[model samples]
Target: MRFSAGFSRAAAIAGLVGFGVLIWAAVISPARDWATSNKVALQTSRVEAARLDASIQRLEQEKAALGIETEFSDIWQARQIGEATAKVQAELGEIARAEGISLRSIAPLQSPDIPFAQAVAFRVEAEATLDRVVALTSAVEFHSPVLIIDRASLRRLTRPGRISPQPTLLMQLEIMAPVFIGEGEP
Candidate 1:
């Protein structure tokens, strides 16, 4: 009887040990591994998000440095092609006058086909000193609403048998500007 009772006690202890091992393998171990994997994934996501945020900030700073406007209000907008061309002419005349340029002719040229905007072009003939011409070109290039000096022809005027200081130049400039049509208009 003593031997049987000892054997029974040993069997019960072995059963409890087996049960503990089963619980640890089937439930606790898998749960712990799942938690670890989730933590790792969360950390990785945070790192990626931080990297994206930094990139966005860098791009925004670059945009600001380049003087790029976020709104389209600064762009030239007109309801008609004639209006756009007139505005371009007026602006060019003003700049030329300010730079002491004598405009011989200012004529509107046919615009090229552009998507979502109309290109307003002009053929401008002017007489000015070299310095004034350079200043005029610079002003047009840096003008708000954006102006492009597509083509420029400069000729130095010389008098026969007379040498004059600061020779005058004949400047023919082809300037272009993009004009956006207003909403609900063709």
Candidate 2:
């Protein structure tokens, strides 16, 4: 009976050990592994979220700093040629007044294709001496008219011996420039 009791006690301990190993394999180990995987996944998602948040913050900062109501790409096209021509005319008039040169003609050429945005050609003939003509040409380039002065040729016309209003110095000038746009499209 004593030997049997000892054997029974040993058997009970062995059974308990096996049951403990089964529990570790079936529940504890798998649960721990599952928890570890979830932690890694959560960490990855947090990092991604942080990156997205950083991008959004950068865009917001740019918007605030620049005070931009519209993106550059969204802006409409075409140029305002008439307003530019008028501006150029005013500037040319001022130049003529300052240089003591009377413009014979301020003809505007509206062509479909010209080097400038508006393709404007000004047939400006003036009754001025050679020196005044040179000064006027230089002044036109610098003034608000912003004429490119692509081509310029000065000719001394044959002045009749009698008093006539014909200009002794004739200037043919060509200018090409890009026009600006405003609230309205051209």
Candidate 3:
């Protein structure tokens, strides 16, 4: 009878210990895991927010450098439709001469009036070294009345003289200039 009682007490103590271990595994371990995951998520969110802030700052700097704010304030600088074609031709000729690009031909195409503006189309054919052609196009882009290139095609020109081994490029460009209807010539 004494052995039986001792056995019963030992079994009860063992059962209590097993129950404690089960509780620790089921509840405490899961709570710790949840907290750790939440910490990781919060850190990820902070990193993403920092990246977005940096992107916004970069975009703002680009806007400022473009002078967009000042460009739009008081007046539109593009020429009126009536004066744009002639002015654009003159400007393009001057740029071609300065950039050392051979001007083959430049002719203004007749286009219908666009809303509140005239769309003046011009076709330019020129031949030069690739570098000189690039320079000419860049100069045209920075010109006051904005010139938009609609179509461009480049072909390798047959070398006429043994001046240089570098292949020359013949560039055909179609450009569009938006001339506001009511604006005056500058």
Candidate 4:
């Protein structure tokens, strides 16, 4: 009987160990796999969210720039070729006056043979100190009304009569600008 009791106790311990292993295989193993896959998916989602946020920011910046371009287009559309040229001339005159430079002439280049709707060219002559000339030219190039400098030349002016307050240089400029033709004309 004593030997039988010892054998039964051993059997009970073995059965308990086997049942624990079966429970781990059936439930714990699958739970662990699911937890690991869920963690991986969460990480991927976080990375995707960051990328989308960056794209949104870039699009917002582009939209703001487009707004500025649209405003400039509206201003351009409101004026005709002659009005645009006159506006540019006025702006240049203001720049010259501000820089204390003498604007000699602002005249349209004769393009009788070519269609007037295509382009309008201007020949501008000015005399100013070197620094003032540089400032005026920079302003013309950067300011609106979109003037393209086709040709630019500069020469030192020599005056033999008397002592001038400041040395001056002569600048000759030829600039071309696209003319806006009304829909009715062409």
Q: Among these predicted structures, which one has the highest TM-score? A: 3
Q: Residue 160 of model 4: what lDDT?
A: 83
Expressed as tens digits, the lDDT of each residue in 1-186 for candidate 4 is: 999999998899888888889989999999999999999999999999999999999999988876673333312222467766676567667877887887899888853233324466778898877888788788767656566677899998997885767677899988766555554532
Would you list the C-alpha lDDT of every candidate in the order shown? 0.86, 0.69, 0.77, 0.74
Model 2 agreement with the true structure over 18-116: per-residue lDDT tens digits? 999999999999999999999999999999999999999999998896785533332212346576667666666777889998777777765436431
Q: Local error of candidate 1 at 150, Å?
A: 0.7
Backbone atom clashes (below 3 Å) for every candidate = 0, 0, 0, 0
Candidate 4 clash figure, as a count: 0
Estimate, for each residue in 1-186, the C-alpha lDDT of model 1 and write its tens digit: 999999999999998899999999999999999999999999999999999999999999987866864454555778887888888899999999999887999998889666556789999998887888889999999999888899999999876886756778899999988888675642
TM-score for all predictions? 0.58, 0.45, 0.62, 0.49
Give all candidate RMSDs, comma-separated.
8.7, 13.8, 5.2, 8.2
| lDDT by residue (tens digit), candidate 3, 47-157 | 999999999999999878776543421222355555657767787788889998869999888764554455778899988888888888888777666777778999988
By TM-score, the better pick of 3 and 4 is 3
